[model samples]
Target: MLYIGLYLVAAGVGGIKGSLPTHGAEQFDESTPQGRIKRSTFFNYFVVCLSAGGLIATTFVVWIEDNKGWKWGFLISTMAMLLSIPVFLLGSGFYRNKIPNGSPFTTISKVLLAAIINSCSGKTTSNAVVNMATSPPSVSTQKSSDTKSKKGQEKTSENESLETQTQSFKFLNRAVNNTPVYTALKCTTKQVEEVKVVLKLFPIFASTIILNCCLAQLSTFSVQQAASMDTNLGSLKIPAASLPVFPIVIIMVVAPIYDHLIIPFAREITKRETGISHLQRIGTGLVLSVLAMAAAALVEVKRKNVAIKHDLVDSTKPLPITFFWIAIQYALLGSADLFTLAGMLEFFFTEAPSSMRSLATSLSWASLAIGYYLSSVIVSIVNEATSRGHHKGWLSGGNLNRYRLERFYWLLCVLGGVNFLNYLFWACRYKYRSTGSKK
Candidate 1:
């Protein structure tokens, strides 16, 4: 029953969270400069609001769970979720509903199939050449050929008039080629371009996963690390789970400063809206994530040394080291999240095809999900390998004091450094589809 309830809740939450960002974005018109800026601002504030909610959870909800009960905490969360529905519906009349025309996947599949067939067949047949040179003359046949030739030329001109196929991925352009066979296949230029946009984003999306894997440490090992530390605050004992409040508070403070102060200053200097480009914002987050892991590793080393000095190696009691050290890494992680998550939301929303905005924005959430899964896999592998011969595993037991967490943090720091380099490679090469005009 517990498993069943968990699965159901996961499915429900996933559906709601996936659609919410796109729904909020659709409220703003993207055709105008004002609308685009508003949309970008919305994404930033959306993250700010999310962090605010997280702050409440880490503090109030955690306190309730610790003092009152878990049931009371769950009840409060359910009430909030229920209340948000009515609040959302109140704005329904103002929202511009973008109706689905048809499944974009069908068009994408057709383009893929047509491209494959065109490549396999080799050399496109020229319809204009066929029509112009094909006959023993009749006045009627001559006139028909002339009309067909004009139509083919007009079609070619139309394609040339719009944005040319990007130099990269020239192969997909076969789907939109003017060849007789490709024309019969009926792939539109817009559809081909949409596929290209997705292709370009793939590398950028994959590079962020390693950063998220580092982040997953916050929810798991970070909490455990805190659990084994002194969590006293002015004679009040704090829960280890509430340590996430550090990052949430950082985001709450940094987000507004970034939006109001940093963005306006950046806009004046760069002469572009949104202050910073989406990729630049994401890259900033990636770099900070590396620093956050490094910070975590250093703190862990200090904590471990203190624990060893006090002879708390096998003891379950909290070490005398201040929990403030953990807060340093948490603060960095939060600031990093503020940059990457908002940038990802805006980037995907702007760059995705109109029909696929929802799906594309969902990739931000999906990356975090993948990172958590990867973290689990890495932990398992690391444990198995390290727990051999005379060596005890880096993350072996319930007692974190016995665990070599500093080594694990250093590993993440190294992984984050490599991932940042990978992100820079893709980000430097990436061309924005919507914000292309912005310097």
Candidate 2:
């Protein structure tokens, strides 16, 4: 029953998550300079809200579950979710909803079919057929009604010439050529270009998966590592799960400093809007994640050495080392998350076609899902391989003190370093669709 309930909740979240970021982003116009800046700034604040929510959950919700009961903690969460509907409705009047244009998927399918047909026929589409495809339905109707109108004929000619000159994804552009066999399958130039934009973003999206795999450690091994260390702050003891609050706090402090001070300084030197490009921001996060994993490995090495030196490796008691050592990696990971997540949100929203913004922005969540899945697979493989030939796996034990967790952290650090290099390769070659005011 608990598993069923959890599955239902996951379904509900999956449905809502895709729409929310695009809906919030639609509030700002992308045409004006100020509007673009505001949209970028909104992405930063979105991360701040996420960090604040996590902070509350790790502290307040964990407290309720620990002292009161699990039922009460769940009840509070359900009430909060219920209250959000009314709060969202309150802003409906102010929203600028973009009306539906025909289905984008249908348009994409037409482009594909048209391309396949054109390829098989081995015949070039003629100028007349191309003109018909480029002209609007209304313009075609007017031409059929009054074939003798010189101005209408000239206007159609101009549009056809412009459509033929489109340079990107030239093969896809063939779908708009005016061929008798493809008259019913023709797509608009804008529709073909939208598909091109989505294709370009695919590689960039795939590159971030390994980085998320590194981040998966935060919720699992990082907490366990902290659990085995001294977590006392004077007379009070800290919860292991609540150790994530360190990163949340760091993000809260770093976001404002980066946005207000660091960005202004960067803008002055670079003379570009938004201070750093979206790709650059994402790259910065990738580097920090590498550093975070390295830091985790080093701290684990120190902790293990201390345990071995004092003959405490086999004991159940917490090690003499402070939990603050674990907090260092958590803090670094949090800062990396802030940079990468905000950059991804803005990049996908701005680069995707207006019609596909919601679908594109949702890729950020999908990457994290894939990352978590990859982490489990990697762990299974490592355990199976190591358990053979009388060697215990690095992560196979009930006791973390006995586990060689530092080796696992170092492996992630190496993977992260390779992923960063891959990200740089794509980010440098990729072109931005919108340059705001500077371009």
Q: Which is the leading candidate under TM-score?
A: 2
**Alpha-carbon lDDT of model 2:** 0.82
Work out how many backbone clashes candidate 1 has.
0
lDDT of 2 at 228: 87
* Model 2 spans > 4 angstroms off: 102-186, 437-439
For model 1, residues 1-439, the per-residue Cα lDDT tens digits are: 8798789889987887788889888887565667778887788888888888888887889889889999999899989989998998998888888787876677668778878888888855222222222235699965874777543643443334323455567787776656636455766566676777766777888988988898899989999888899999988998887787888888889988998899889989998877889999999999899999999989988998998899998888889987989998998999899899999988888777766677788889999999999999999999998998887788986778778888888889898888888888888887665642354
lDDT of each residue in 1-439, candidate 2, tens digit only = 9999899999988877777788888898666667778888888888898888888888898899889999999998899989989999999899988898876677778877886787677755444534355646697776684765544554454345445545767787666655536578876665666777887888889888888888899989999888888999999998787887888999999999998899889889987788888888888989999999999999999999988988988887899999999988988888998899888888898787777788789899999899999999988887887786777898997988878789889999999998889888998899876645234
Q: What is the lDDT of residue 21 in candidate 2?
A: 80
Model 1 misplaced regions, further than 4 Å? 62-72, 117-164, 176-186, 436-439
lDDT for model 1, on a 0 to 1 scale? 0.81
* TM-score, prediction 1: 0.85
